[model samples]
Target chain A: MVTISCRDLDVDLGGRRVLSAIDLDFAAGALVGVIGPNGAGKSTLARAMLNLVPTAGGSVAIDGAELVGLAPSHVARRVAYLPQGQEIHWPLSVERLVGLGRLPHLAPFSRIGPVDQAAIESAMAQTGTLPLRERIATELSGGERARVMLARALATEAPALIVDEPLASLDPGHQIEVMALLAARARAGGLVLVILHDLAAAARYCDRLVLLHHGRVVGDGAAGDVLSDAALDAVYGISAWRGEAEGAPLFVPLRRRD
Target chain B: MSLLLPLLLMFALLSGLLSIAVGPAHIGLPAMVAAIEGKGDPIVRAILLDLRLPRAILGLVVGAMLGAGGAALQGYLRNPLAEPAILGISSTAALGAVIAIYFKLADTYSWLVPLFAVIGAVLALIPLLALSARGESALTLILAGVALSTLAGAGISLALNLAPNPFAAMEITSWLLGSLEDRSFKDVLIAAPCVAIGLALLLGQGRALDALSLGEDGARSLGTDLRRTRLQMLAGIAIGVGGAVAVSGAIGFVGLIVPHLVRPLTDRSPSAVLLPSAVAGALLLTTADIAVRLVPTAMPLKLGVLTALVGVPFFVRHLLRERRLW
Candidate 1:
């Protein structure tokens, strides 16, 4: 188990501040959904945690170890990231693509061992991508490709998983399926932070919701507490109709705020 | 894919052997075998051991370098069209060789031309890397390469214009056409170390290149050091292609064509394409060299000329087939 903590994190991109003075802590065994309107720096926050983007100030650490000071391979062993764009440049088979997740674990010249193979198989099985292992990744449907990419991330078996916009191209069924998989991963003692645009799904599946507007966290806590009507209107510029369905929380954007 | 690698290696070996056998002074297989055993006629032995063998070896080495360099560049840039020549390294090296020839340096020092050419190749990478360091896209990189190539082409033309005599000018022109003819073991020795170092660097990057196929951010997330990878790739291409151009002049398209032809056979994995592409490149150049010898032209056709003739058409066809990508 790992705890990812960020203190006053700031990021600047091309002279524009994308994220500013952000502080958060992600404990293991929770599915945290980062939700915001477009251009709220959701992707930037995720990238900043991984040190993929240059941080202007402040510190992000995993279990009190500075993330920026660690070697990329070391950080990768602790945190696995699934970028927003699902880019597979080559026509590599699904199995080979997922096997890339084993990179940080394997030595430079060593082949994939039995333990690595088991992790890869388990990841594929969990993501329902085992059946498409031999198929070319580039040829897959958007939903299937997203699952394959998710499997690639899961194959890392890192303590912290940061996924951005995972439900963008997925259908309704696949979206819930992916959300359930992420929730299950958290239940199984992994820290899963996913960025979701769908508020309903975000509330339904995530144990905690981080609502951001223009790079600052406006709401963060349990799903019900964070998705309050006033908070939704203030941050999202919309009113949401909240109700309970089958003992699970449900939220639908009702109208744009005047 | 496993079978393809061995087959390509076998074909490259056969082509190299054929190149050694089919020169103007035909040392038949029996005589060649005797020469190998150190028991052939002195004349046949001298011709086979001194002339044809070095030329064949040079062709094989230069071809392999370009091919592997091409694959490595393509994989790093994540663009199928990326090659040694695309980034202006070859032309810059050619310019260096031409300047050496124009200054009569080639006459005074046999090694001066290749030495300058290697310097030129390494120098050309400076701007290419500087542009990429600013986080330029692939299109920007290609555009920068075009500008650099044009600048180097102008430099070559200036060197040609400043030649001491028409005969010197003519010599520079033909040399620019690129050939493996009359190369000695000395030439082989000169280029081998740099090419070997470059190939080792490129080959070691297989796993990193595989990670990069997921795009830059994805690769970074997977623990790839993009900056380090970029540096290694730039240095590898510069050293490898520089060494090749130093010896063989400007051989075009071998780098571009070989990788594409062999990619499918390698399951389209950029890392997996490297070795096979190198083998296929050696085979292509060796065959082209043999054809140059056998075609019975009044003047021997240049290897670069033949490759362009074949490669340009195939490239056009590829563009047409993948037109939607643009």
Candidate 2:
């Protein structure tokens, strides 16, 4: 099983403290949602964990080895990251865009082999983007572009996947489909951490939740426990109506606390 | 894309042969073939081997350098408008060559002009790249390039103003206007190594450029060493463009125009566009050089002037079409 742990991590960007004294552990076989209000350092935390951003203090480790010491390609083989924005500069075809994920696995001059091709095909299939394989990526709909980006990340086939705001431009159907896909990946023995803004989706889909406020973790536990009215009101500054729907937790934010 | 490479190569080869054959001292195919095989008249052999061959070769090399360099810069910067001359690399190189001319260093040593030009190109690149390394946008880079180009243009004017004699000033003026006229094999020898090295460096970066298409964050997560990629790209442009300017002065627009024309044909892959753009660049410049020979002006037309005449309109059209980019 794969595990990622951060100990008292601190990050400062442009002389501003973005994340401070944060500690967390992520394990395979679970879908964890990182939900927080704007500027709560959710993206910073993810970037810091991946070593994409410099940490001011403390350490992040993957399987007991410090992440900072690992080669970037080695780190890439273990963790896949999907950034928030869906920016595709060139109008590359979907297949070509998705094929870029195999870069870390192949040599610079090497052509895609059988295993790489299979992984790319499988990732596209999982994201339901195989039908759009021949279409231009930049010309796709917002939701389709998001799916293509997700497929690019999934094509990495890394043990752990960290996705930031994957549902931002996706429709309701795509949102549910993507959520289910993440849950299934976790169930299949991969660690999946998703940053989400939709409280209801987080409550229904994630096995666990990590709630942030002022760059600190205010809540971390099972979804139902972390989505308590008090925790929600304090961290998110909103009072939420919480209940169960078909044995699944449901959360609805009704009013601002102030 | 598969067919485009061969077609471009064939076009470059045909254009190069046509350029050699179309010069003032025209030699037919039979004589040209005999000249190559060392059985032609001494005058015919000298005209083909000593005069036209180097000019044609320089045209091809210089064009290839500008085109490939422009494509690589565009790919690296993620902006379609990026080109060597616009980025101030070529002007800085010209400034170096002009300074050499002013000091009579070029008169004494044929190689010093290109060497100093390469140095100047590399120096200009340092500031431009430093701005980009700070994560500046494309607009900032273009603005910086414009500033550098303006400053270099002034420096060239100053050199002209301070020229020791009228003849010296005229020589510097015409050189600044840019030309491939009267160049010899010595000029080709000077530029070939630098161009070869620069092309190698840039072409090796295809995979990295592809990764960079996803933006810096995406590229980093995909295991692309962006710092290294940026360094290689800057160095490649400096050496390649500096060498070309060292020999042929500042031939503009080939870099900017050829890549845009060939990009769609290459499936829009930045890596895929490099070789074909190089070929297209060679073809365009050689054809332009032939146009220079045929234009029948009182004095020979400047290669750089012809390119600017063609390129400036294309650039204006691009800006008007992509007005939203600004």
Candidate 2 C-alpha lDDT tens digits along A186-248:
999999999999999999999999998888999999988898878877787789888888999
The local distance difference test score of each candidate is 0.89, 0.89
Q: Write the per-residue lDDT of candidate 2 for residues B1-326, one digit (tens) a residue.
A: 67898998999999998888988776788988998999979999999889989999999999999899989988888888788777788889999999999999977887788788988898997788878787525566677778988999999999999998999999898887778888898899878888998899999998888888888788888888777787787788888889999999877788998888887676787888888989999999999999999999998899999998987887688767755423
Each candidate's DockQ:
0.64, 0.57
Least lDDT summed over 10 consecutive residues: which range in candidate 1 chain B?
Answer: B317-326
TM-score of each: 0.96, 0.95
DockQ of 2: 0.57
Clashing pairs for model 2 are none
Docking class of 1: medium
Tell me the tens digit of each residue's lDDT in model 1 across A1-258. Answer: 799998999999889888888999999999999999999999999989998888999989988899978999999899999998899988888999999999989898788899999999999998999999999898898999999999999999998999998998898888888999999989999999999899999999999999888888888998899988778878888998889998889889889988
